[model samples]
Every structure is written in C-alpha cells, then in structure tokens.
Target: MSQRSIKITMSAVLLAAATLASTAPAGAAHGGEPLTDVRVATHFDLAAGQMPENITLLPDGTAAVTFAAGRQVALVSPGGGTRILATLPAPADGGVHTPVLGFPLTTGIARTPDGTVYVLYATGTADLTGLWRLRPGQDPQRIAALPADGLPNGLALDAHGRTLYITDSVLGTVWTVPTTGGTPTAWSTASELAPTGFLGANGAKVRGGALWVTNLDRGTLLRIPIRSGNRAGAPQVKASGMAGIDDFAFTGRGNEVLAALNAPNTVVRIRPDGTSTTVLDAADGLQNPTSVALRGKDVYVLSAAYTTAADPNLLRAHLRGHR
Candidate 1:
C-alpha cells in the first residue's frame, strides 16, 4: 500500500513524543539502550525520488537498495556515495493498472556472494510484475512471473541460496521459486499472512531452516518452518503489537532482531521472548524507516520519508554490548 495509507492507519497508535521523553534514562535519551552513535550516513535526494525501500549489504560495506517509487535499484557506499544500478522500464500504461498502491514499485532485495542481485517489482500487470534478476553487467530480467493481482512485497534467498521465497501482501501468500527462475509455487497460504486492510507479509528472511516474515497490517512476526521434502510446517506467530513494521534483520544474537516500524518512524529491537524496545526513533532522523540491515557492529536503516515527505536518508548506529 501507499505511504499515505500507512500514515492514516498508524496515526491512532503512534507513540507520543512525550512518552518517549519520559522513558529516557541516563545514557539513552536520543537512542534507547543498547543503541548508540546514531547518525545519518547519507541523505538521499527525495526530490529525485530516491526513497529506499529495502536493503542488502555487500561484504565491502556497500548497500544495494530498492527505490520503491522510482522503480530503480542503486548502491550506496559506506562513505555516502550513491550509484544508480538499473531502472526498471515502466509499463506501457505507466502502471495505471498497478494493484493496491496504484503505482509500480520495487520492493525487497537480496544479493548473493557472486554479485547476483534479485529484486522484486510489482506493477499490477502480468507483463511487469514479478521477480527480476540482475547479473553483474546485464540488464535486469524477469526470472519469475507473479500474480498481477497480488502485491509482491518481500524477497529472500534460502540458506543454500538455491531457492527464493517471496511474500505477497495482498494475496497473503508465500511463494517459492528457483534461483534460476521459473513458475512460482504457492508455498504457504497461512491465514496469519492475510492483510487486515492495508498490507501483510511485508518483509521476509530465511534462516535456521525456517522463513521469517512480518505482517504489516496485523502487526505480527511469523515463522514458517521449512520441513523435510521442502514442505512448509504450520506458521507460528513470534511477536506482535508492533504496528507499521515494514522490514527486519536478525541481530545474530539468536532470534533477536531489529525491525523498522514504518509509519511510527521508529526502529525497535525485539527480543527472543517477543518483547520489544525502542532502539531508535524520530530523534535519530528516522522518517518512515523502511528496512534494517546489520554489518558487523553497524546498524543500517533506510528511511523512505514516505509519510514525512522529507529527509529520505540512510542512518547508521552502533550496536552496543554486541559480542
């Protein structure tokens, strides 16, 4: 769905600024405990339509990000350099047929060690909505065809990188496709993945033989085990009460995670027990934070400024007490 849609849905539950101030303690005023050194690493040109939607980090500290509204993928370096990689061609009708959001958008992204980048595009048209693969120097190619009626939102590669799993927010399904590209399989259609009104199954990741996903409208984190013979076990809701959560990254500390709460303009650290704490908020320059990534001790956050419509940028923070 659109940012305006999210803002309207989240307005009632937005954490008040006064509540945040009252919760501040000695050393964690701006950023809550276990998060520090928060700062903007790069300020994207919002006027140029450079709002980042999802991110994947390379080994060299560079980030491959999908510009949701721009229908483009670009790389951002640690030192704040930016480079446009490729722009997906617009549909003949200019995405007028696009689903819920009413426009074509690039969503989740995942990169392999060999530099093969796979990203998702949703134009609500059969000819252009699906998963696209981009080799080092080749133009982006549609590898798999997804349903035009569904909103393909999140993308992830499995443990061996042999399979790609996708989340369709509108359809409330999880689709699996081979890395080489082919027809997608509706791997799971759990009711938990259904959207309340806006969107569902927003962000996804595969780890520990299970696929982890977030439902934006339901405000819940779900895990579906990858059982033997490539079957999907029953889904389990791991966490809830986080409205507007867009995307998340595992903290490498067991099941701990850092998740971006989009309309709330906050990033939170969720513990294994399902409890969450506000790690970074608007005070740290978060403007509709879309995704979170972790590279060693650094925490990378992409703010699309979708609702705020100002300061679309990337912020980095230090993860304290991270062993």
Candidate 2:
C-alpha cells in the first residue's frame, strides 16, 4: 500500500458515493419524491419564516393561505407570489381559536360560491374552537360555531355545497354542519366510520361525493362517505404510503389528485384507484411545503418555515398553472 495505491482507492470510493447519490430517490429521508422543476409558482415565497397552516384554492387562479403562528391569511398567486389578507380573532373574541385546535395552528380554510371565505382556527383549548367566516368588505363572521366545549378542524364542502364536513383531530372523527349555518349534524356520528390509531385522520376534502382525508402520522389517504347512519358507510383507505402529507386537490372532474408531503416538502399525483407517482420533489418542488390547491393546470403550494439556527428569513415557492 503506497501513495499511488492509496490515491487510486480514494478515487474509487468517491466515484461510488456519487453514483449512489444519483440513483437515490429524492426525499428519501421522509419518504417522498425527488426535485425536478424551478417554477416558483407563487410571486412571493412563504417557505422559510411563516408556518403555513393550510391553503384553499380560489376559482380565479389564486388561493387563500393561513399562517398558524402569524395568525394571518394570504392570497397567493397561481405561480408563487403571496399577499397577506386579514388576521383572525382569538377565541377570547368569540371566534374559533382555542384549546381544540392543534398547537400553533391555522387549521383550515374554505370558500363559498358567493365568495365568502371561512377559515378554521384552533385555540389549543378543546372547547373554544370552531369556524370563522370572512366577507369581501365587512368584518369576519363565525358560521356553524360549535359550543364553547367542542373542537373542530379540517373543513370541507359536500359535492353540492349543502353540507360542510369537518375533521376533529383530537376527537378522531368527522362532523357535518348545514350550509345555512345551524347546529352541526354528525355526518358520521358513529365511531365505526371514523379511523383510529396511526391512521392519523386529518385534512378532509369532499370531491365526487366522496371524502378525501390525509392521515397525519401513518402517511396515508383515506376516503369516507359524507352521509351517516343508513346513508353513511365505513371509511376506506384510498391511498397510502405518502411522505408527511398535509393537503391535496383534485382536478374538476379528473381522477388525479396532487398531494402535499410537508416534512420532506414535495407533491405527488395519485390516481383514483390509489396508484401514485412523484410529480414534484423536495429539493426542487418545495421546502417544508404544508398544503396544496389546484385550479385547472395551475398547482399552488405553501412553503412554511425554512429558516434555521443559521437563517431566520422566510421562504416560499410558486409553481405555474398546469392543466
């Protein structure tokens, strides 16, 4: 073993390392996709400093985003730009934002056909959280508010917009409230329809008469019927094995759904039957992405909290509209 031999061995080891890196899937650490594109879809980056709690798409190619810690709402462009909307009130102010909501939580957001915006807030207090509605010009309103002793999160509308379905993470179930804003009827009042354990049921959206849910820890996608009792059926696992998924969106009538994998920061497309493929990877697709929304070909993702002990500034990415 002389100098020449040592040098040759070192070179060989370096080459092997590079080869392995090239072949490995992106987001392998958290189980997600690889980086590929550079389409900073939004105009402003919300990736680093702000913790995006949730995002909902608007028809005009924009999206409403909620920052959990900042307690602010943002109107995000189809590409990657962001505009801050109104902040929400605390439960002390009568709106949902109490014990029931998860910690540092933005919870969820939804929009009505008439352009009414509703954002769900959790106060970390089990009994004080519910829903907050914001109109175009007036102060925000609270619709379908729960009793001071209840919890609510993950909001969704039925196929016809008649009912709003919500998932309570702590309660481990989904509930429905009428559109006119009255007492909420338990959509799946029975525990049999709700999942349990590492199933991690959260982030629900109704599409095509079915409910789509993101399983927080187990890394899965779940589907359940909106109607309960005789009309309600047991929940099923629609898709599974995702990477820290948070939110997802489906094309108007297409079978494709783009799911957000938050931890590794990526997006993946899954078919109606549960097969999936990587559409966006972490290194390139996003950084700490929390939620996703789609209108036509455009896909919107919110990048939350990329800053570290070395960096404190915020960051974000906006992918252009896709068909």
Best-matching candidate per lDDT: 1
Q: Give the CA lDDT, 0 to 100, for residue 258 in model 2.
A: 71
TM-score of 2: 0.73
* CA RMSD (A), model 1: 4.2
Candidate 1: which pairs clash?
Answer: none
Candidate 1 lDDT, 269-296, residue by residue in tens: 8888988888888988999898999987
Error of 2 at 157 (Å): 1.4
Mark the regions of model 1 whose C-alpha exceeds 4 Å error after superposition: 1-32
For candidate 2, write residues 171-201 as lDDT tens digits: 6667677666766666664443233432245
Could you list the CA RMSD of all candidates, in the order they appear?
4.2, 11.2
